[model samples]
Target chain A: MKKLLKYDYQYLKRTSKFIIFPVVIIILAVLSPLTARYLNEILAFSLGDQAGMFNFPDPVVFDSYVEYLSNLSDIYLYVIIFIGVGTFINDKTKGLYPLILSKPINRVKYLLSKYMTLSSLIFVSLMVGMLVFSFYTYYIFGEVDLLNVFLLSLLYFIYVELILAIAMFSAMYFKSYITAVMITFAGYILVSLINVFSFEFLKYMPGMISSNIIQVISNSASTPDVIYNVVVTLVITGLLVVLSITKFKKYDLN
Target chain B: MDAIKTVNLSKSYNNTLVLKQLNLNVKKGEVYGFIGKNGAGKTTTINLILSLILKDSGQVFINEEEIKFSDLAFKKLIGYVPDVPVFPSYMCAKDYLRFTLDIFDLGDSMVNQKTEEILEFVSLPNSTKKISSYSRGMKQRLAIAQALIHDPEIIIMDEPTSALDPIGRNDVMNIIYKLRGSKTIFYSTHILDDVERVCDRIGLLDDGNLIVQDTVDNIQKNFFSNKFYIETKNEPKFVLKKIAKINQVQNAVKENHGIVCYLEENTDENTLLKKLMEMDENIVEFRRVKTSLEDVFIRLTNEKTT
Candidate 1:
C-alpha cells in the first residue's frame, strides 16, 4: 500500500495539467453562488417600485445553497469525469503503465491507487469551494445554520463519488483519453435524456438523481423520495466500482 | 545451475507464430550475446522472460524457480533496459530514482547512496534536468542507471547501442566491459563486432530457432576450412599447377605470390605441408587458413534458408 501511494504521488506530481483543470473548475464553482446573488439583486433594483407590488422574496442562504448544488451537479461533475478519464489513458499512451506494472506491484493495487488519488482530490476541492461559499453567504445574508451547511457538504461529497465512479469505469473501458471522455459525456447525456420521460422517472436516472436529492434536502420536496434516490445512487456507485476493479485486473497493460 | 533457461517456449500473435519451440540456456556469470537480424524475435523472447506476455507453450525458469507474473521475486533478480526508454518526461532524475526505490521498498538511508553511485557510474552525475529536456544519449544513460540501481544478478539489454553515434557507442560498450565481472549480461544486437569485442558466448537466432550456441573459439574451430596457403620463391603458376595435380588436393588457386590448396576431408595438414616441401624447396610460408565468424554466420543462415 505504501508503494502504491508513492507511485500515485509521482503520477500526480508529474501530470500537473490534470490537476490544474480541476482547480479551474473549483474556481468556477466558488464564483457561481455569488454570481447568482448579484443577478438577483440587479433584477430587484431594476424593477424599482414594481418589485414591491409583486411581493418578491429577498435572496437568502437557501437560495445560495440551491445555486451551489445546481452548479456542481451540471458543470463540476463533468470536470471530474474529464479528469478521471485522463488519469489512466495518459499512462497507457506514454508507455509508463507497463513500466510500473513491471515492478513489484499488482494490477489491483495499481487501479486502486488511481481511484484513491482522484477521489481524494475531488473531495478536497469540493470541501474548499463549499467553505468559500459558506463564508461569502454568511457575510452577505447574516448567520445561517452550521449543521445544515455541513449536511449539504456531506451530500455533495457522496454525489461526487458516484459520478467519479462512472468516469473511472469509462477510463478502464477505453484505451484513449478522448474516447473515454466522449463515452462518459455521452453516458451522462443519455441519462439526462432518459430523465425527460416524466418528472418521477427522471428523478431515478443517475445523473439527475443527485440533484433531485439535493432539492429535497433543501426542503423543496418530500423526504421519502429523497431517501429512495440517495439509496439507489449509492448502490449503483458501489456496483460500478466493483465492475471497474474486475475489468482493470483483466486488462493487458502492454 | 544455469542462471536462466527456457524450454520449448512458443508464442503466436493472431495465428502468426512469433516464437516456435525455442530453447536457450545461459550459465551463471557469462556474457551471452543474442545475435539476429531485425524482426528476429529477440525482443519477444526477452518480453516472455520478463512475463510481460503470456506463452502458448513451455516454461521459463530463473534461478531454478518457474516464472510467475504475480510473483515478483524473479523480477527483483533481473534488470531490463528496453531499446527505447520511456519515462514520464515531467520528472527530474533524482525524483525518478526515488520513485523507483520507493516502489521496490528499499531503505531510505541507502537510496541516496545507491542513486549517486549509479549516476556517477553511468557518467550522468550532476544531471538535475527534467527528463523532457534530456538528449537521447543522456536518456539512455539514465536508463542504464535505473536498471543497475537494484544490483540485480542479470541485466537484459536490447540494442543498447543501436541508435548512438560512434562515440556514444564506445562509451556504452566501455561501461558494459567494466561491469563484466560484477554481473552477468545478456544483450541482443545485430552488430557482430560488438559481440566479438565483449561477449564470452553467443547464440545465433534464425527463423525462430537458436541455430548455433557456443564459445567464440569453439564456433571458429567447428567451421574450420581444410584450405592451406603456401608462399613460394618460385613463380605461383608452377606451384599451383603441381598442387592441383596431387591426388589429395581437390583444387589449387593462385593468390598473390602464394598458392591456396584445398584438400579433401581427413587430409592431414602436416602431410600436405611435407608433400609441398618435397615438391618445392623454395616454399616460404605454409599454414592453414582460419575461418571467421562472419563465414560461420553466413553458412548457418544459408543452410537454414535452403
Candidate 2:
C-alpha cells in the first residue's frame, strides 16, 4: 500500500497534464459565472428584435448557476476524460509499468492508486470550480443560496467521479489514448441513448444524474427528482468503480 | 546451500516452448553468468526467477524460501536491472532515487547517504537532469544505482552491457567486480569477454536447455583439447607416425606447419617433450593452447545438436 502511494505521488508529480488539466478546469470554473452574466447580453445582440419572441419570467441567480453547471457538465467532463486517459497511457507507453511491476508492489494496489489519484483530483477540482462559480454568482446577482449550490456541487461531484470510473476503465481496457477517449465518448453516447428509451429506471443512468442534478439546482423539479438522482448516481458510481478495480487487478502489465 | 535454485523450470508462450525443462543452481556470492544467443531463453529464465512471468511448471527457491508471486517479500532480497531501464521522464535523478527509497520504506538518513554513494559509484552524482535526458549508458548506470540502493543480496541484470560502448562496459564491469565478494551477481549476456572477466561460473543455454554449467576454469579444462603443438624442421609426417606409435600419444595429426599430438591421460609432459626433442632436435616451438569459454560454449552447444 505504501509503495502504491509512493508511485502515485511520483506519477502525479511528474506529469504536467495532471497539473495543467485541473488548472484549465479551474479557469473555466472561475469564468463560468461571468459567462452566465453575459448570456443575456449576448443573446440580445445575436437575436436583435427576435430576442423578445422567447421571453419567460424573470431569470434568477439560480438560472445563471444552472447555466454554469450545464456548461461545466458538458465540457469539463471531456477534460476529465482526457486527463484520466493520459494517466494510464503515459505509464504504459513510457515503460514505467514494467519497472513498477518489477518492484514489490502488487497489481491491485497499483491500479487503486491510479483510480484514487484521478478521482480525488477530479472531485477536488470540481469542488473548487463550484465554489468559485458560487462566489461570483452571488457577487453579480446580489443574492445566492449557499445550500442549493452545495447540493448541486455534491451531485456534480458524483457525476464527475462516474465519468472518472468510465475513463479509468477505458484506459485499462485499451492501450491507445485515442481509443480510450473514443470508447469513453461512446459510453457517454450510449448512456444518452438509454435515456431516450423512456424507462423510468433508465433515468438513473449515470450521465442523466448529472443533468438531473443541474435540473434540481434550477428548481425545475420537485424534491423527489433530486432524491432519485442522488440515489441513482451513487449506485451506478459504486458499480462502475468496483468493476474497474476488478478488471484492473487481473490486467497483465506487459 | 545454493543462493538460487530452479527445478525443471518450463515456460511457453503461445504454444511455443521458450524454456524447456531447464535447471540451474547459483551458489551464494558467486557471479553466475547466463550465456545464450539472442532468443535462447536467457531472459525467460531470469524473468521466471524474478517472478515477472509465470512459469508453466517449476519451483524457484530464493534463500531457501519458495517464491510466491503474490508475496513480494522475496523481492526485497533481489535487485533487478532490465535490458532497458525506464523512469518517469520528469523526475530528476535525486527525486527518482528518493521515490525508490520511499517504496522500499528506508529511512531518510540512510536513503540520502546511500543515494549519494550509489550515484557517485555510477559516476552520476552531479547529474541533476531528468532521467529522459540521460543517454543509454547513463540510464543503465542509473538502473544499476537504483538496483543496488536497497542493498539486496542478489543483483540480476539482463544484458547489462549490451548497449554500452567499450568505456561504459568497462565502467560497469569495474563496479560489478568491486562488489565481487559481497553480492551475488547473476547477469545474462552474449559478451563472452565480459563473462570471462567477471563471472566465476557460467551456464550456457542452447535450444531451451542448459547445455553447460560449471566454473569457467572447469569448463575450459573439461572440453579443452589436450593437444600439444610441436614444430620441427624434420619432416613432420615422420614425427607424427613416431608419436602415434608411442603409448602415451593418443593421436598425432599433421598440420601445415607442424604436428599436434593428443596426449593420453596420465602421460608425463616432461617425458613427451624429451621424446619429441629426441625425435627432432630442430623443434622451434612446442606449447599447449588453453581452451577459452567461447570454445567450450561452442563445443558443448555443437555437441548437443549432433
lDDT of each: 0.76, 0.79
Against the true structure, what is each candidate's TM-score?
0.85, 0.88
**If chain B of candidate 2 is superposed on the true chain B, what is its TM-score?**
0.86
Poorest lDDT segment (10 consecutive residues) of candidate 1 chain A: A204-213
lDDT of 1 by residue, B243-283 (tens): 88888997789998898876776788887878877885577
Candidate 2 residues A1-254, lDDT tens each? 76666667567766665576568666776677776777777777799989888763455786777776777677777777787778866787677765666777767677778778777776677677767777788887877778777777777777777777778778778888899899988877776576567777776666576567666766786677667766776777677777776765555544
Report the poorest 10 consecutive residues by lDDT, candidate 1 chain B.
B217-226
Which stretches of model 2 miss by more than 4 angstroms?
A: A47-59, A220-243, A251-253, B227-230, B234-282
Candidate 2 chain A: worst 10 consecutive residues by lDDT? A245-254
Interface RMSD of the predictions, in order shown? 2.1, 2.2
Candidate 1 accuracy as lDDT: 0.76
By DockQ, the best candidate is: 2
- Report the lDDT of model 2 for residue A253: 45
Model 2, DockQ value? 0.46
* TM-score, prediction 2: 0.88
